[model samples]
Target: MSGDLHTEWARLFAASLKDSGVGHAVISPGSRSTPLALALARVLPATVLHDERVAAFFALGQGRASGRPSVVLATSGTAPGHWLPAAMEAREAGIPLLLVSADRPWEVQEAQASQTVDQIRLFGAHARAFFDLGLPDAHPAALAAVPRIAAQAVLATRWPLAGAVHINARFRKPLEPLPTDRGEPWRPKLAAIAKAGAPRLFPPKPAPDPAAVAHLVEAVRANPRGVMVAGPLPALDAPAMRKAVARFVRASGYTLLAEATSQLRFGLEAVRPIGAFDALLRAPDLRAALRPDLAIEIGAPAVSAQWLAWISGAEAPRRIVLPGERPADPAGGAAAMLLGPIAALLEAAAVDLEAAPPGADTASAASCYAASWQAAEAAAWAAREAAAGPQDGPLHEHHVAPMLRSILQHGGTLMVGNSNPIRDLDHDVPPDAAPLEILHQRGAAGIDGLVSGTAGARTVLDGPLVLLTGDVALLHDAGGLAAAAAVGGPLAIVAVHNDGGRIFERLPLGRDAALADDCEMLFVASHGRAFDGLAATFGLGYARVETEEALRDAVAAALAGDRPVLIEARVVAGGSATRAALLAAMAKAAVAAVSAAK
Candidate 1:
């Protein structure tokens, strides 16, 4: 009826993806995906990859970075299932990924079809939505599904509760055979637009009953050491509720332990920036300050085991939460689950409270520790600035992270590989005054999604994105580099090649006497000079840095270049001892300062 089975299949796949909000697709090559692969290859804004699992996670990372669903395309059987880890991650972390699994035609189904398996229900509970394509339906009905299925997948991914969606498709043979009058492939030029929907439900919610508010106020008023603890929250109407919360905190004279991921965490001096309450509670003075008659909980729970343990085992019998529906404890374990928003309830209370007394040192020592941490960061950067010099050749992974930071300037988002790259970055790069969004595959902590994530971030923001990765991560998503080059956007990759898994050498695996001294399986090593050739092969700008000066110059050049560039830095494994020594020196300075202040 048409040109060839592959052509029709390819057209449907492209149409479906384009109609959805997903502008990026990570494709892993295989025979089963010939039609889908050919379709993506001919289309704009699609990337072809070699590793099925990595490609899926790359797309998953892209979705996480961009705030949109990024599609994953792979051939059937284990190839489709390779997306399991990434799929599980997206489901839990609220990133959306569309899995397009190509399969054998229905005629060959369950008949020992090559590379065929029951792809349906494979993702099981991991996917938010699932659809099996290539049924006996008419072409018109099939065509009609292209847009709706795509949109649903993206919506399911981008929502607050996001997850994976599967589109299992089977294609007939002669996938892309020539036709007598094979016309140029149709490329749809329609722009994506928001769909018309019912008016959003922003129903007017009244404040908690005045008596209930009074109950909370009376509870706080009765206790001399009542305090407020705020946790991470979904985006709140900060401006609308700030005044109310401030008045409540002022009325109750409650010390606020604000988390950075919370609505009230920022824009306040008294509220401390302690990352994990557990870390703070370990200090004696901080634990003493937390000796409260009542702890008013708000929003989601904090990420501190110490805080929870302290509350669970308090000597003074702390009131860990105020009560109501949509309460502080999602697990129903808090002392009291307060009804209504804290700010609203507090407003009704309007109980008289005192300001923190001048020179009273109301804040815990942990608050001071946070300030000291800032000073240590400044001192670390000062040394780095002094020690900063140019070098080129095989690069040290340890050195690359900081140099990349210096090269990229302060504001752009940066994604790093796990293992050595991220560990190196966390140790070296100092905190900036400007908002620098640092991202990683921290949820799953995989090394396979660097390029896809970078590309997705590039699409969402008009700003530049630089990926500082190690050789393993680079090779894992090397095919993604081609996508970067093809897109011609603001993304740069700096790959540090130390040859083999340097992380292993630092582990017990390297030191075990049972292991062979020169075993290929355990103790592998590489000479870091291959990135230039690899970059050239992929049509990307290549810079080879061997000395300190050359490394700096190469980094500077890549940042200033037009297209996505790769700077390959090589160094030996043991070269990072200097960095470790420097960190230890700075940490000692902080420890000494705390001791001396006493």
Candidate 2:
């Protein structure tokens, strides 16, 4: 039967999206969203995905890759909930996801509405903003609520705190198809939806308060040994801060320590901080010498537990934080918080700070910082290298990361799988070289999204794309490889094969040798074979390597071609020895480096 509800919704929803700067949508098909699905299909840039969970993640990756919001459409009930894991990750990692879920109208809902679960607040804590665009009779509210809710959600997502937005549209039945004109495209012009929300853009401004700046400048000028730590900011905000803060830090004798994820790693007077200093920062001499008179922070929460803890305990001159309406850190106990634009605050201080004067003293301080960092770096690398080695000249986890790193350094873009591959890459990937835009399936950390994320990256980025994944990750997304290979692009899939689930084997449950056999039977369900054949089956090039040298050669050779290739390297399964040996070696190296520097 025909219905105006579906058509009205389709029109409103389509127009809302068009107005919201959403150029693409990743949709998963189903009955409840017939009208909505049709609406998305009519939208040119939208793409359809079969799995709702993968679709959500694919959209997340698309958002990350494109630097814009990507809508995820799914039918009602269990399907919409499939997005939970992705939703959690997006919330934490700060990506924009517009979740458009379809539902049965009110009367039919809850009393066996089939695919309905009071979805009004279904996502709850995970979503930054929530709205319900129910039936056409409520189209006015639907038009009003969706755009406003989404803007807030996206703003929260892009702000100091990141999260997703949820919009559930309940449709009344006979959910009819919409009539449209043919030939000419179905482009609908949307009137202003409730006088569009305020732009979330952060503008350049002078100091927020002249008095506050002057006080900060006076404090810095007085303290000879202060440290300025900058945290990770969104890609959009980091550059401007980097330029503004560079002159300020250099003027005072303060050292600038920036995190790897900070995006400010390239700017002037910025030194890459030690990743974590839980153990190192506790040292009596280091603590006393490095303690700052004042600490100024400008970015998201610091991820290092040690750094946060150290600053909390160390009696500094004062703690001044420039959050600018960003979320406050509950852990930053007793630190003075300032609510204003950071650049403006700095400018108001009007302190003419210069770079640390050159000479033996400056050289000495640089040496001290470099030596400390080198020691930590060496210890980490050594420990990881010791624990991870080639298994009988065949594949091993350690062997694969370095090899893949080698290949990627030679010009291919890298997409790392979640879990072990990323950790291994962190330990051994070449550090001195340019930063590789590392794409991780961090949202949900599922194994099913690698192929699609890698492929999506290839489409958006101009570089040669490489996906470094584990065996399980590769198998879970086997179909994705087929799609990628079929698409035929300059992509490479490198998998570190260790049978299955080595991460589980490190648990205390694995300590019982008698249980090991049972555990393997229940958990390590694996088919130890080359996925190269799978690629070849799809008419794609494939390479299976046993040793480090072979893998490197294969990767190098693959990079020379235009076709997509899959290189599988079988590694020794990680066990208790792997963990123990790695930790011990790292500790030993750390002490040694610290002793030598002293």
Candidate 3:
């Protein structure tokens, strides 16, 4: 007759998740979630991470790359609690993450017993959809709804938009189905179940509405001098949406400034992207000159302090944010929003904008305006070049970004660890460098999961994988290396060994004398501990490179070998003092150069 309902429930859950197109399952170690965990691990290609927070973010990264929901599994109690930050990020970033957590059963939790707490709605607003799947049963309705519940969870995570969905699986144990418990019916029944497992689509993407297209085109026509800003875009399930974004930007006769995380930064032969806009916007004169009649931001707000300030200062009448999954103003400055799927909107607008006659003076003016911004961007970079002082000291912390761009092969991913590494990328990554795919935890922008997340991405990405992080960030999530070592992927970390939280040195908090007393020990927490021992502990290849050439060589050699490697580039991090001074000089020079421009 029927086996453990918990086993059947979990098997059905995994079946429907796989059926609904979830590509990967990232499970954490826990006793309560044993049945579901084992079922999902066996059914789907699974990765087991020790930390729930790291596992969730790693699942988040996998979602980013694959454009599909990755299941993050955890046991009852504080384990599910750790997934909140990543869940919040998934919601805001528009990445679909399905959280499969085993929760305490009602009877156990009712007594307020050990390892039992109320797990209902634990993630608060962070989860886009929440389901408390009651304790598994062999009842008719429940058994029938098992696959459908799994399929519905898939729909909920990605439905009208994309984000995190929480499935709190409450299990009454006899968690695993003992092979002997099945009696004599096992063999033939298993053969029949295997015959029925097939992939499915719970809900596909929406179609383009003609009315929505008209409104988008009309909005663009009204603003002839619009500039396109591409920020963090959602992980698109449709591949066509990917190409459509670039084509739309290119055909719009508008200048495009894309953030590194935006994914639109690459495949830009059809369009010359403004990678230097963050630095260029630093020159007040250039930012003012490029001020448009309308600012059409295609994605979310970028990670550029200069751009954020400049765009925020522009009059509200000039701001037009493309409709997000949610209706709120991400930029806090959107005057209006154009409604529709971004793919459909961009595809429709591309055709309409291209067809609009040259007789339409607005179209011609838009082209000239785009070209003018391009020329002005070149001038700003020229000023930055002129402002550069000779670096006779050790390889500057900023140089690692440009150097790694060459080492990672085409179609490779470079996930930037948070703090100075990402900011440096935003400020000075060479414009001529080949556009490698870049990923960032720009959601919460935390340093907690970089190691684990990088390890997660290597599961899906076939090319050379690298993590560009600093000293402190590495130490913050050092425990995550256990997962990395176990995953057995040849990973490379271009670690900038700046001992302390040196990122603060550039801000007023570091420069201000009032805060100098605690600046060293409290704010920065400088530690001169060695890294080789840490590498050995984690079974990672360790190389300390003193010169830029040696750093490059070490990174290449490490990537070529079979083990996970840590290539440490020694840099004196005085709170980014050197970077701050260099950028200031460049902005000053850029101001002088653009002073004559209209």
Candidate 4:
């Protein structure tokens, strides 16, 4: 169990992680990190990823999927720097991650060693906490502090708010497990301490404040026209919170508006949440008609621009935000921030609402408000279905959503990319679709690490894993193809190739006729390259689909296979026009339906 002081110290630290319930580790190979990497491999399921950035995001996906911190080990200096992007995402998303960076001794660091930088507090505000475990020592006092440091680091990742924690371990010249004469007497004691393991940690759960609950109940009573807005939530608690929220909506008689990543969007058809709210809200008439007197927002801010705009106007509804991990009031319009377990708060509110009796007029108004939202929801979906073109025609990005829903109908994990993919899925996928575990990096909302993150999630999750990303995002993380191969799972990457960033076309800059050339040159950054050769280089299965049927079959076959597959759906550039057309049709139809219902 021990070769040198560094070996013993690293083993003790790794054992503490296991004791604190860390189950997985992602390692990037390097010399300085040899001891910690070897130690972690012994106690947990470890994967070696060549790229540190990819490894960090891979660990991020694991944390998001598993609801526990996954260890990410890298050498000192710039290796840990690569983790900054993923760390920022983890912080914003409330995912737990443990980043261990190995460094040179203090003297060498002072002398400006080759692979050493100021590893202390490297992640700045992005990390929940930072620890610099100075040079490894075998003194009984020093060995005793190892487990304490590990415990504190792991706890910090989850407490107050879930995010990442950094531990910078500095080692002497012999970074390997070579024998040394420094700590011969402490060997048996160190082994015993490692064997005993650190004490298991149980974090306290925050309860809903009685005063806040009473205030929310009174607000709901006063405002019969209320709506529950469910945005992106922590994956682990989403299921429980979904049930609780459904109970609250029924008790309070409010319509539910759920985003795609909200987890409440699917599996709650009984509650009948407004599935097409993004399109429905686009119509000014409908937005005015459905203006809620009170809005109960849970989880992070939604991804829909229309939703944000609707909620930001002068007549915006009073927002009661139940923040998870962090405050989610980006519009700065929250009337109340209920700080506690969201499910618990919702459950408490539901109980209070059930106990109170509403007047007949209040009951009638709430029922009518919910009914109007339902009519608009139905109309929006009807319009989208009516506008569907022939399946055999040229592929468009709009087709990916329903095609994916059909492919993964039974059960699977769907990781959507940032750009148009997530937005499309949010607008198109309905509540009737089978419940699939949807994952996205909506924390920072960037398109950098979709492939590697999905691969990482595969290591922890069961069933087939599918990543629906754009061509540009796929290319950005092309190196992650190697990670997908190494992890070895049924991962189907559906890369929607629109030649470039088609999402930019929807913005103001793309709409300007004079800026067409500039938009194409800089904003879109079109790279007309096929992914077949890239797949071949990584030894992954490859398929190119241009028709709806082909896409369906390719995804089904890819899921059927055990290895990773890249299914590129090549569509013409500028599909945003088609998206705009569909939205306009949906909005018009929704307004008409709402007016008729009234």
Worst 10 residues of 2 by lDDT: 182-191
Q: Which ranking of candidates, highest TM-score first?
A: 4, 3, 2, 1
Give lDDT: candidate 1, residue 86: 80
TM-score versus the correct structure, for each prediction? 0.66, 0.73, 0.90, 0.97
RMSD for each of the candidates: 8.1, 6.2, 3.2, 1.7
Report backbone clashes per prediction.
27, 10, 0, 0
How displaced is residue 521 in candidate 1, in Å? 6.4
Deviation (Å) of 388 in candidate 3: 3.9
Runs in model 1 deviating more than 4 A are 1-20, 26-44, 48-54, 75-79, 134-136, 139-149, 173-399, 459-461, 505-529, 572-580
Which TM-score value belongs to model 2? 0.73
How close to the true structure is residue 229 of candidate 2, measured as C-alpha lDDT? Answer: 62
lDDT of each: 0.60, 0.62, 0.73, 0.87
Worst 10 residues of 3 by lDDT: 233-242
Candidate 2: residue 209 lDDT (0-100): 69
Alpha carbon RMSD to native, model 1: 8.1
* Candidate numbers, best lDDT first, in rank order: 4, 3, 2, 1
Better of 1 and 3 by TM-score: 3
lDDT of 2 by residue, 1-598 (tens): 2224466447556655655566577788888888877776675367677777767766776666666677788888888987876788677666777788988777876597567776787788888777776665534544455555545544544555456788787776676664544222122212354235323444244346656666677666655455566554544454466656655655554555554334443333344344323333434555554455567766655444446776666453356676555554545653567666776565555344332243556545645655565575556556556655543475656566666655555444567776567555543442433344556554445666677656655555676677788888888877566456534667777877778866556556656788988777776665666686788776777877777888877777776788888887765555335645654555555666666777
**lDDT tens digits by residue: candidate 4, 1-598:** 2457787788889989989878799999999999999999999999999899999998998998898899999998799999998999988888899999998887776686698788889989999999999888767888887887889889989887889999998887677778577568888878888877887667887888899889889999999999988888766676787789889998999998988788888767468888788888888898899999999888888888887887788868788988764667888878888877888888998899999868889999999999999988888888888886766788878888888987887878789999889998987777763577789898999998889889889898988788999999999999889889988868899999989998889999989999999999999998989999999999999999998889988998988898999999987556888889889988999999989987
Alpha carbon lDDT at 212, candidate 2: 63
